[model samples]
Target: MSFGDIRVAERADWLIERVATAGTLVLRKLGETRAGEKSVHRFLSSPYVSVERIVETLAARTALQCTGRRILAIQDTSEINFAGRDKKRRGFGPAGDGKTPGFFIHPVIAIDVESEAVVGLVDAEIWTRAAGRVTSRRSRAIEDKESARWLSGCQAAASVLSDAAEVTMVADRESDIYLLFARKPERLNLIVRAGQDRSLADEGLLSMALAGAQPLRSSVVRVAPRGPGDKGREAIVELRAGTVRLVRPATVRKSEAPEDVELTLVEAREVNTPPGKTPLLWRLLTTHSVTCAAEAENIVQLYRLRWRIEQVFRALKSDGLALDDSQVIDAERMFNLTAIALAGAIRTIQLVDARDGGPRPASDVIDANFTVALERLSKKLEGKTLRQKNPHPLGSLAFVAWIAARLGGWNCYYKPPGPKTMRDGWNRLAATLEGYALATQHENPGIP
Candidate 1:
């Protein structure tokens, strides 16, 4: 089940072709296409799709492909914002900040952390709304940016992921409520982070039982505040071993007031903060029975993998695809655009894994190989005179040739080192080395 062996050099090409056709097209058209950053934006957005699918597929495939190891299904969601001038602005309302306009894209992504690959993506719908008082479901849906759509999306993902074996749903505090937990349609497991005001009388009793058996010790870990606006505030909380029931704050519904639910709390935190700061510690609840400290730690770590979704966000933006700068108008177009960007982020993960080396072959290696081939071709035919005309022999055009030449097994001749040529030559040499590695993978697929 490990990525230790498996030659997918051929598969790399297939993935790359997919990215080129669907993934890249959506990213470039999303936004900033007219700014001459089309290529840059395209590159940034192509990886999300590949990575998400790869991780999900790998996790499912591994469970089926391997007999001993079980697959862990991880699901989490985050918000994607849009600007006023964005094409989707008409669809977007005030995004809580009042100054900016945006809509949210909620992706309930499932990944196999053990294998470090994305298994499935739930990039269907998003729900967004501005903060206000007297929120009702009908009124909220009207004002809701994308929540109804997001709900449907989450429901569909639940149906699809119900089939995953040994699947565990790990999410942040937002998903720790009854709406998501109480009615799981599939054979799914959940371990959600608890909210501060969650009613935990039952959990408190159980915690007291466990606490009576063993002494509670204080452990401190510093955590940075959540959200985009909050900066530089770090909270150091004292951790104690205890249990608490998780309850969602009740929404006033006509004649009905509110209700609470019970969940096991294993470890509770007592936050130390200055005045005006809210005290919070996770009233963690899980379907899986946590017996020992190690088991509790495992659950905590699994929840931590929720952060991988953030990495997925970065891959959508800083890595190569800028999801924030999207220009797609209308909700449907924006969703499609987001899907494409997700695909791009997935592809980026594959690219990194391929170059860094993983179980399956990545197109990045092929890219590296082709790049070297063109450099060699430029050297043989154009020679030193070409270098004089364009000192950077491996210009963008040469890179394309390098890809073709390496695939064709063209050899690169060594150019005599000159003072001005060393840096670029060294770079080319590195490219050649990468090309050689890639070519070797194709030539001897089983060697790894």
Candidate 2:
């Protein structure tokens, strides 16, 4: 079956409304009226709309935008637990905590490597674990375990980003699986942090090999802020790079997989750390070659983009959309709503990314109907000077971002606007667009 045009319009309107409301999952706030709320509920509860189809629609859009770009397929898993409301929830099993009623969402978001702009969602893995005692890792295959998300994510990236010049699958330590390397998709690159000390093909330990290698160089790296009022700090880190052969663990169930895989290892060990704080260490394994310090640093920098997924989590959870506070009692509807909220969270982040001028088009986050209104709003915000005026071209993501930041109350006097300011500005813009459209239709019945 295909997604109907009416369904597309409804979802598009929902995306706009969701961002305007800071990703709230409540139907009451999203609908704003009894009829409106019921419509939203019906949309989510519709038997015709499945989670897979919803995600596939978004993936198709992402594929179109990623053509001829170096794409980063960043994947991460986040839990959505209903805490005390687990009892009332139906169709939900034990969450990560083993008791809460919720499911997990593992989503891969495509980002333009050069522009640092969001492309769109590629795939999402949403599932609920059955209530039972789990088998040991050695007894279960990667396919049967939660760890298969990495391989699935890579395959999805390869299929969706086939037109891209280059594609790299990046993730944290939990993704350091041998099957991922042994059975990687064609032309798909990987950058995963090592999680455990494994045997090397040369009869040596993996950690000792990197530690024994000479330091490549040192550089300063920015640490992300922990929360509000906490400006993150930077630290000087020593770099080390080497190529090592990794032996497949005996515990792995896939006997047909390769016995050994050769990959470069890049390590960044922080020096002169602040008191009471542990030093930062990153053991990155990648398919790309790194023979020089510059190449090693490049790999490290790319891995830093993994933080984007972390920000997405913040937006989807307590900071932006409070999915846990959702009033939905059915697990299926909640899962469907989660997919939309995930996209909305990314949309909010995209606006934040464009607060300054950027290369992405505004269509990345808004439809064409709002372009004229955005232009009029831009005129109202622009001053007489170049610095006072918008720096990005019209119809660009950055152009729309400047309007959002200004509407959010940035004076062009202080630090650039953050996520909160961007979301607030977007909220105001959404309201303004609705009012403008209504007023336009009222005064001129022919204008749509």
Candidate 3:
């Protein structure tokens, strides 16, 4: 809907408040208060209430937070599988099982490189594949393809973060497109995993070039457990760095021909993997120069922060937002709901990330009532021992997080709580605040 419409603005504000307060609950539950069920439905069904507008608003807020900082625009794609619904459902395509129907979402999230805090979502695109559509990869232009999302994401990030000191476009192997590198903006740099064994300027493949480089450094890195079947472990990894010039692929048309792109490649391989454990191997390509082991390690660390986007996806999925469980059938309505959910997911991560470090004020994220409720909760959650008491300054994000973590059952001895724990804590705290608000309203009937 157009921003000029007062109804659209009112609905947008309501949706944002609902998302921030209630989180991933179904619409009936979210709008159960003042607006009622019909209002919620009308809000979602409104043509002026759009996914792009919602995303743009949130992205602008994110960009404001990123002022004067070196931000990492971490981009990645995840499928929203709505498989097993009624076969007559209209707006979906082949998903996980190929027979099931769903769509894909590609998002670029800006992160503070120094603090590793999730700044905000820079941009997001949602689309479904055309039914019965198939095109030869070599013949189609990049502009007409889905893979162009990577380049577009980079461009969007560059534009949004123009005032920042620097913007590094970080991605996984899936984003290692030749055109992305050749046409990358001067203001933007890249740190993507190498997916192709391309021909180098010195007549050698990328893999061979990396394999020939001598190890420059060694360090131990923690590897998070991937699944229930595996255990988290630490491994000693060796780093190697090299520079290579990537040649243009023959598949790219003459008119679209791009100059050879020179990139610094760094490989981090585990020196000794435990029995039954897979060794860590990451070959990273970057436009940033790496002359020393410290510089290479910095690049590796930046790439590691790419996991933040994965956390966002997890927040949107079953573990957090439960987006796949959404009952919306129409594509437009679903996209609008997903946009709201996306904003909620980012806020969830922001709270979790703000727990330990950073000087962000709690008021910037949490409402005064929520913060007051958490403040009341802090006294009860803290222990007699000084160390067990809330260590963060009052009115700070860390202070609220500390209380939430305690309410979520963190004993203060284990590692800091992740997003799931914080989510549980926030849900409980929200319920408490709701009850408190009701009691306050009853005590003073005429209060506005």
Give candidate 3 misplaced runs (Cα > 4 Å): 33-35, 86-88, 229-231, 368-377, 409-415, 431-448
Per-residue lDDT of model 2, residues 111-196, tens digit only: 88997777788999888889889888777777888999989999999998899999999999989998888888979999999998
lDDT pick, better of 2 and 3:
2
In model 2, pairs of residues that clash are none
Candidate 1, superposed: residue stretches over 4 Å from native: 1-80, 84-90, 127-154, 201-262, 268-281, 353-448
Q: All candidates' TM-scores?
A: 0.55, 0.93, 0.91
Give candidate 1's TM-score: 0.55
Candidate 1 structure lDDT: 0.46
TM-score-superior candidate, 1 or 2: 2
Identify the leading candidate in terms of lDDT.
2
| lDDT of each candidate versus the true structure | 0.46, 0.84, 0.82
Ranking by lDDT: 2, 3, 1
Error of 3 at 138 (Å): 1.9
**In candidate 3, which residue pairs get closer than 3 Å at backbone N, Cα or C atoms, i.e. clash?**
1-48, 1-49
